[model samples]
Target: MDRVTVSLDELPIRDDLRGQKPYGAPQAPLPVALNVNENTHPVPPEVADDIADAVARALREINRYPDREFLALREGFAQYLGHGLDASQIWAGNGSNEVLQHVLQAFAGPGRSAFGFGPTYSMYPLLTSGVGAEWIGGTRGHAYELSPEDAAEQVERARPDVIFLCAPNNPTGTPLPLDVIEAVYDASHGIVVVDEAYQEFAPRDSPSALTLLGGRPRLAVSRTMSKAFAFAGARVGYLAADPALIDALRLVRLPYHLSALTQAAAGAALQHATTMLRMVDEIVVQRDRMSATLEALGYRPSESWTNFVLFGGVADPAATWRALYDRGVLIRDIGIPGHLRVTAGTEEETTAFLEALAEIGAR
Candidate 1:
C-alpha cells in the first residue's frame, strides 16, 4: 500500500485563522509584573482556606459528572450581579473567553458580521474571525471614548449580527458613558454583548448594560472571577442575559463546561466578595497614585477606570518597554505602534516601574 500523502495547502482549516497568534500567553518572568492586569495580591489566607474546604467537599462528587445544568452556580452568580435573574437567565463556561465564543457562535457566524471599537480588547476580533464572522472596527473619540453616534451609523450601515463593547475597555482602561452605551444598545438590532471583565475597578457610577436585560433581549453582560476575585487559575466566567439568550448559550456550550472544582471555588469567592471588594479599593487607590506619578514623569496616561493605566505618545514605546523589561518589570506592549499599557501592581512594584521609566527617559 502506498503511504498516505497530504499537502499543507489542501488543509481544511479556515483561511482567516492562518498565522494568528494564540491569546493570553505570557512570555518570560519579571520582578514586577504589570502586564496582564491580574490582581497583584494573592487570595487572602482566609479565602484560600475556604477554597480548600470547598474543594475537599467537592472532591466527594468527583466520581460523578458535574451538575450539567450549573443551576445553583448560575443562581449565585445572578444574585452577585445584583440582577434578579434565575438560572434560566445565566450561563457558565470554562472561562469568560469560552462564554464569549459561544456568543459569537450563536449570533455571528457565516454571513453575519460583528462590530466593536478599535484598540479595545484584542481578543474580540480574533474570536469573531475564529467563528468565521467579519469584525468591524470603529474609531474612538479624543479621549478613547466609543462614539455611539458613529457606532450607530455603522451599525445602521452594516447591520452587524453581533456587537461587543468592553466597558472600562482593556489596554486603554477608559469607561464608556451610560448614554453612549444606551445609544449603541438602541441602535444595535442584533445581539449586544457588554464585556465587563474589569468592572470591579470602575467607579460606582460606571455604566452597566446588565440592568437593561429585561428591556433588551439583545443585551448580555459577560463577567469573570479571574480579575478582582483573584481566580485567574480557576477558569470560571459567566453571562447574564434574557432567559432565551441564556438558553441559546446552553445549546452551544459543551456539557459540564465548568468543572466542579471551579464551580465550588467561584461560589466560595462570591460568598466572600467583601474581601475582594476591599482589595479592589486598595488597588484603585494605588492605580490613581500611579497614574499621577506617570503623568508627573511626562507620560500622558489615559484617564483610567480600571486597575491598569495606558500611556501613549512615547518617542519609542518599544524602547520604553525594553527598558522596563530590563529592570525586571513586565508591562504589556500593545504593539499598536506607539502605545503601552501597565497594570497597577503593589506599591513597591509601582515604584520600581516609575524608577525604570525615569531612567529610560533620561537616556
Candidate 2:
C-alpha cells in the first residue's frame, strides 16, 4: 500500500489553530539536561519500592475500572495541602495542564476569553485556544513582577471568563505574592486559577494560595507531583477549590479519567511525602548557588522561588545556549531577548552548567 500523507493545512482544522506552534522545550540527550524545571533528583529507593508494591497490588484488579471520583487520592492531597481542605473540595487530572484545561472547558469557550500576564506559563494561551476561547495577554511590571494594584486593574479591564496566575511564574522564576492573587480574584467576576507547580520549592515560610481558598468559590489552586515529588514521569496533578467548583469540573472531565495504576502509585508516593520532599531543600540550595555564581560571572540572575533560575546579561542567548549544548549541558533560551533559564539540578549537574557558562564567557 502506498503511504498517504497530508499537511495540517489541508485538513479541516480550526482557523485559530492554524500557524500556532505547540509548547515544548528542546529535548536533547545531553550529559546534564536542566532546561525544564524538573526535580532532577531520583526518587528515594524505599519510596519507589513502595510505589511498585502498590501498583502491583492494583494490577490484580486491572479488570475493573478505577474509581471515578478518585476519593482516596483526593484525601491524600487534602491532607498534604492541609489548609482545612477536604476531598469534596479537590479535583485532579493527568497533569496540571489537563486540570487547567478542565477549568477552561467548564468556564470558558467560544465568545469568552481567558486572560494571563504576558511571558507567564507558555501553556496558558495554548490551553485557552484549544478550548475555542480568546486569550488576552495582559502585561507584567518590571522584571516580570505583577503588583496587587496592577494585577487587579488588568483583570478588571480584561474581564475575561477565566484567569491564570502562575505563582512564582515560569521561565522567569519570579515569585507571585498572595496579595496579587487576592486582588486578581476579587477583581474578576469569573474563575481564577493559581498554578503552584513549584510551590514546594518556594521558601518554607512563604504562604500558598491554598490559604486564600476560604469562602472564595471561584478561586482554585492547582499543584503537581511532577516538580517537588520527583514524579514528573508519573503525570499527577491536582487542584483544591470549593466543592461547588469541584463539581463544575466533573461536568467536563471524562469518566474514570485517572487510571487505577496511576492512582495507586500516586497514593503510595503521598505516604512518603517527607522523604520525597527532602530533595527540594537541596534543589533550593543549588538554585541560590546558581544565582550567586551567575551574578559573579556577570549575569543578572533573577530571584527565584522555583527550582530554576532565569539569568539575564547574556550578550546573545542563542550563542550561549548553543555553547552550553556543545559542552554536554542544556538550558533554555525562553525567547527573552537576553535571558536564559536553567533548572537547579543535582549539585554536579548545576556545577557543569555553571562551568560551561563560565567557559563560554571566557571565550
Candidate 3:
C-alpha cells in the first residue's frame, strides 16, 4: 500500500477555522523577553523544592488516574479565595482557558452568541467561533475602557448567551470596575464570565467580580496562578462560581483532565502562596517606574493595574519592536496599530528594556 499525503485545503475543515492560525505570542530567544506578560521571576527556591518533593510523591500514584473531582485542589482554591467559598464552588482545568472553554461549551453552543469589549484577550472570539457561537464585538472608549452604561447597553443590544469581562485585561492592563460588571449582569440574562487572569496584579481596592458571585448564579470569575504565582508552566487556571455552575463544568471536562503531576505542582505552589506572591509589589513598582519612564520618553502608556503596560504614540510599532529585539530586549506588538505591551520583570530586566527603547527613540 502507498501512503498518500493531503493538504488541509483538500480535506474537510470547519468553515470558522479555515484561515485561522494558532493563538499565541511569538516565541523567540533574546536576552530580555518581556513579551507574554509572564511573571519574570522564577519560583522561589524553597517553593520549588517543596513542589519537587510533592511531584516525587505524586509520581507514586502515576499508575492510577488522577482525582477526577480534584477535591483537595478545589479546596485549596476556595481557601485562597476566602469569600465563604467551598470546594463545591470552585472548578479547575489545565488552564483558565480550558475553564472558559467548559463554560462556553455549556452555555454558548451553535446559534447562541457571546460578546466582549474590544481590545481584550485575542482568544475570546476564537473560542466562541470554534464552538459555533456567534461573536459580537462590543465597544470601548477611546482609551479602551468600558463604562457601566456602555456595558449594560451593549449587553442588552447583543442579547448574547455569554459575555466576557477581562479584568486587568490582557495586553491592555486595565481592569473593569465592579459597577460595570454589575450593570452588565443586570442587563443581560445570560452567563457572565469575568476573566480575571491578571487580577493579582490589580490595585488593592480594585473590586473582584468574585464578590458579585453571590445571588448571581449566572456569573463566574476565572483566575489563573500562571501570572502571579509564576506557574505558567504548570498551567493551573480556575473559576469560582455557584456550586450548580461548577457542576455544569464537570459535564464538559474529561475525566482526569488535570494530570496528577499538574495537581501536585499547583497544590504545592498554593501551599506557599504567600511566598509566590512576594514579588507582586516589586513588579507593580517596576510597572509604574517603567510607565513613567516611557511617558517621559514620549510614549503614551495607559495606566496599568497589571504587570505589563500598553503604550501608544509610536511612529512605527514594528520598527520599535525590531530595534528592541536587535538590542537583545523584547516586548510584544499586540497588533493594535501603534501600541506595544511590555511585561514588568526584575529591575535589571526593566532597565535593559527601557535602555533599549530609549536608544531606539533617540535615533
TM-score of each: 0.95, 0.99, 0.98
On residues 1-363, what C-alpha lDDT tens digit does candidate 3 reach at each position?
999999887789987778878798888889899999889998889999999999999999899999989899999999998889999999999888899999999999898999999889999998988788999998788888888998899899999999999997876887789999999999999999999998888887777888999999999999999899999988999999999999898888888899999999999999998887778888999999999999999999998889999999988999899899999988999999989999999999999999989888887
Model 1 TM-score, 2 decimals: 0.95
* Shift of residue 166 alpha carbon in model 1, Å: 0.6
lDDT per residue (tens digit) for residues 1-363 in model 2? 999999999999999999999988999999999998889999989999999999999999999999999999999999999988999999989999999999999999999999999889999999999999999999987789988999999889999999999998997888998999989988999999999999999999999999899989999999999999999999999999999999999999998999999999999999999988888999999999999999999999988999999998989999889988999998988898889999999999999998998898998
- Candidate 1 wrong stretches, greater than 4 Å: 1-12
After the best TM-score superposition of candidate 2, give how far the Cα of residue 339 lies from its true spot, in angstroms.
0.3
Residue pairs in steric clash, candidate 3?
A: none
lDDT of 1: 0.84
lDDT comparison, 1 vs 2, better candidate: 2
List where candidate 2 sits over 4 angstroms from the true fold.
none
What does the lDDT read for residue 112 in candidate 1?
Answer: 90
User: Where does candidate 2 have its weakest 10-residue lDDT segment?
Assistant: 166-175
After superposition, the stretches of candidate 3 with alpha carbons farther than 4 Å from their true spots are: 1-5
lDDT of 1 by residue, 207-262 (tens): 57677677888889998888888888888888998888987887787777778888
lDDT of 1 at 10: 75
In order of listing, the candidates' clash counts read 0, 0, 0
Question: On a 0 to 1 TM-score scale, where does candidate 3 land against the true structure?
Answer: 0.98
